[model samples]
Target: MFKRIAATAAATVLAAAGLVACGSESGENAPGEGNDTVTIKIGTTDADQQAWTAFEQKAKDEGIKLNIEKFTEYPPVNPALDEGQIEVSKFQTINYQAQYNASAGKDLRIIGSGEINILGLYWKDHSSLDGIEGEEVAVPNDPSNQGRAINVLVQAGLVTLKDGAPKLTPTPADIDAAASKVSVVAVDASQTPSAYHEGRPAVINNNWLSRAGIDPASSVAADDPNSELAEPYINVFTVRAEDVDNPIYARLVEVWHSPEVTDALNKDSGGTAVQVKRDKEELNAILDKLTEEYK
Candidate 1:
C-alpha cells in the first residue's frame, strides 16, 4: 500500500515540475469534464525530489503536467506560491506556515502533507549519547530551527536550558544549564553534514541529512516526530487561501495519501517519515489555529 502511494507521489511530482494538465476548478477545470490540459506550478524545498518524482509520473498519465520550483530556506517558499509565480509549496511545518502567515499577514492554506521529517543527531565515532558529553554539539543558525535543534539535545538529556529558553533568542548566554562542559555551535543548516567530519556531534535537518545520503534512523539520538513538537510541527503542503476549494488541490492530497507514495517514503525515508492520516476536522482545527497564529 505504501509503495503504491510513493509511486504516485513521484509521478505526480513530474507533472508538477512540467506544468501540464494541472487541475484547477473554474468551469475551465470542472471535474470529469474531459480533454483540456492545465499546468500546475508547485514550489517546494529540494528535500523531496524523489517523492515528487513519483507523484509527477502519475500526473502525466492523467493529462496534467506540473512545474516544480525548489527553494532551500523556509522564508521564500510560500510568498512565491501566493504570487502565483507557483501554485503550491510543500516545504513547511504547520507551525512554520502559521508563523509565516502571521509574520507576512497572508492567508496561506495547507493543501496536504507529504514527507520530509525530523533530523537526527549524528557523529562519526560516538555510538551513543553518553559519549557525547563535553563535546561540541552543532545546530542550525536559523531562528526557529536553532531552537528546534537545541531541543533535540534536551530530549536526549544531554543538556538542559533555563525555562523559557525556546521563547528567547538563543545565544551562548541562553545555555544556562549546559551539561558541565558541553558546548553548542550554530552554523548554516547546509553545513551540518560536513560538521560530522569535523568531529562534532551534529543536530541535523532530516532533508539535509538525506541529501548527504545519511540514513537518519541509524544516526538519531532523538527525533522530533515522537516529541512534543509533533502536532504544530508536522510538515504540510501550502497554497494561497484562495485556492483551497479547488479540486486539483484535493487531487494533490489524494495523490499524497495514496498507497504508492506511502510505501516509497517508508522505504526511502529510513523509516523516519511515517504516513499520518489527518482527518479534515482535525486538520482544520489545527490549521485554523495555526493560520490565526500565523496571521
Candidate 2:
C-alpha cells in the first residue's frame, strides 16, 4: 500500500508544485486564495475518498470549495498539511498523529473526530484465536499501531505485556513471551494481510483489510470501540495549531460530519468505520494527552 503511496507522492508533489505558486511570493499562504469560492485542501486515505463527493457538494453549497488530496499511506498527509500544501488531513488515528508530532516536533492540533477503525487478529489457516495457539503471528511494526496490535492480543487472552510497558506504544520487547501462548512477529503495517493470506495469523489494520479482500467481520478477534483502548484509534482531522479557529476550516469540518458524509463513509468503509462526533477542544485535549505519552 505504501509503495503505491510513495509513487503517488512523487507525482502529487510535481502536480501540486504549481499549487503553491498561486499565493504570495513568501509562500506561507493557506490553500484558498482571493476568490468568492474558497478552496480548502483536505488530505485523506483512498478508502475515505468516496465520501469527498458528498462533502465537496455540501461545501460548494456553502461557497467553500474543497480540494480532496488522496493518499495511500499515513506518512505523506501530515507533511503535506505541515508544508501548507494541504489545509487539513483525516488520514490518521490520534495516536498516529501523536507519533508524528513527537517525531516532527510540530503541534498540529486535532480539529475533529471522523471515524474509528476497528483492527483485528485475522488468520487464513485458523478459524479462531484459539486455533492459532502456539503458532507464529504477525502485527504492524509501527510505533503507534504495534501497541494497538498488542492490545488486541491482550484482549484476546493470548499474551500479557510487562507492567511498565507503554500501553499505547508497546513493542515486541514489552511482550511477556514466556507467558504468551503464541510467538508474535512485527511486520510492516501494509504486509499484515498478505502475511495472513500466506498462512500466518496476522493483526490487520481495518483500512488495509478491504484491499486484501478480507472481511473485518470474519476476524478471529477485533477491537471493541467502547473499550478504553479504542480512544487512541479513532481517526481525526488535524490542522496547524494556528488555523484551528479559522471559520472556513470549521465550516469544512462541519460538512465532513454531516449525515451525508457519514453515510458515505460508512458505505465506503463497508461498515467497518464507526463515526465519532467530538468537538474541537475535546479532540485537542485527547491529542495533547496522547502526544505527551508518545514523547
Candidate 3:
C-alpha cells in the first residue's frame, strides 16, 4: 500500500473535484455504523451522489454500509484510498487509472467499470460553432483524454495540435501555434465547463454534467462513452491492488451492474452513461491494451 498525505486543496480538487464536504473526515466514517463500518469513499460529485443514494439503499439490504463521499477533481482519490482515508474510489477512466498506477506507483487495480458519460466541448455563450467565430478553447494536459479533446475540436474543424502530441498528454511545447489563433485554450478538466461561461469552451466528462445536471445534447456537443472510440477511457472502480480478490469488491461490482444501478444511471444521466457488462477477460484485455497504448 502507498502512503500519501491528507489531500491538499489543489490535489483534492484535481483528483476528486467537489468530493469533500465541510467537517467530513477522510475515511473516518464507517459504512453502516459510521463508527465501525468500512467507509467506502465513493468519490463523485452531483449525479453520482444522486444515483449512489439509491445504490446505498440497496447495499443496506445486503448488510454493506456505504458512505457516498463527494470529490470535485480527479487527483485525490488514489491518495485517499492509499492513506486508508477511503477503502475504494468510484471515479475516473481506465486511462487515468493506468497513468496513476504507472506514475504514482499506487498499485491500484480495476475492480469494476462504471458506466460513464463522454466528454464534449461546450461554451456557455453560443453552445454551437455558428455563434462564435473566434473563441478560446481549453483542453486537459493528460495524454489520451487531452488528445481526445483536441481530436474532437479538430474533428469539428476547430484547430489542430502541434503534430507531436504524445498519445497521453502534450505540453505547450507540443502546441505549434498559439491557442489565440484557433480561439481555444488548454485548461484543466475541472475548469473547462465553467470556462464556457467566459467564452472559454472546454471538453467536459459526462459525470461532471450529471453532477451539475447540465444537458449536453441540449446545448453542447457530446459523444457517447460506449462509442467505438471512447471505451478505452471510460470510468472504472478501483481498489488497492491487494484487494483485487476481496469479496466486498466483487459485491460492489455486482451491485453496480445490477438492473437497479442501470436504471438509476440511465434515468439520471439521460442515457449518457451506459452499462456494458463485460467478462473479466474483456476488461483485463482493455486494461492491458491501455497499459501498452498509453504507457
Q: Please, what is the TM-score per model?
A: 0.73, 0.79, 0.64
User: How many angstroms is residue 77 displaced in model 1 relative to the true structure, after the best TM-score fit?
Assistant: 3.4
Question: Candidate 2 residues 1-295, lDDT tens each?
Answer: 1145643563355356534312223444434344445556777875346787887787777666666778887788898899988888877888888888988999998877878877889888566766677888899997778888988988888988888987766789999988888889999999898898898899998768889999777888887876777788888888998778654566666677778888888888778788877788877877888888867
Predicted model with the maximum lDDT: 2
Q: Model 3, 106-191: lDDT tens per residue? A: 56777767776656777765646675446667777546567667655655666655655653344445554554245556676666
lDDT (10s digit) by residue, model 1, range 53-103:
777766555555666777877678877887877787776777777777778
Better of 1 and 3 by TM-score: 1
lDDT of 1 at 50: 64
**Could you say which candidate leads in TM-score?**
2
Q: What is the lDDT of residue 179 in candidate 1?
A: 45
Minimum summed lDDT over a 10-residue window in model 1 is located at 24-33
Candidate 3 residue 185 C-alpha distance from true site, Å: 2.0
Model 1 TM-score?
0.73
Number of the candidate with higher TM-score, 1 or 2:
2
Q: Return the lDDT, model 2, position 163.
A: 82
True lDDT of residue 74, candidate 1: 66
Where model 3 places Cα greater than 4 Å from the true spot, the runs are 1-48, 67-76, 83-86, 123-136, 140-145, 154-183, 188-195, 198-201, 205-214, 266-271, 288-295
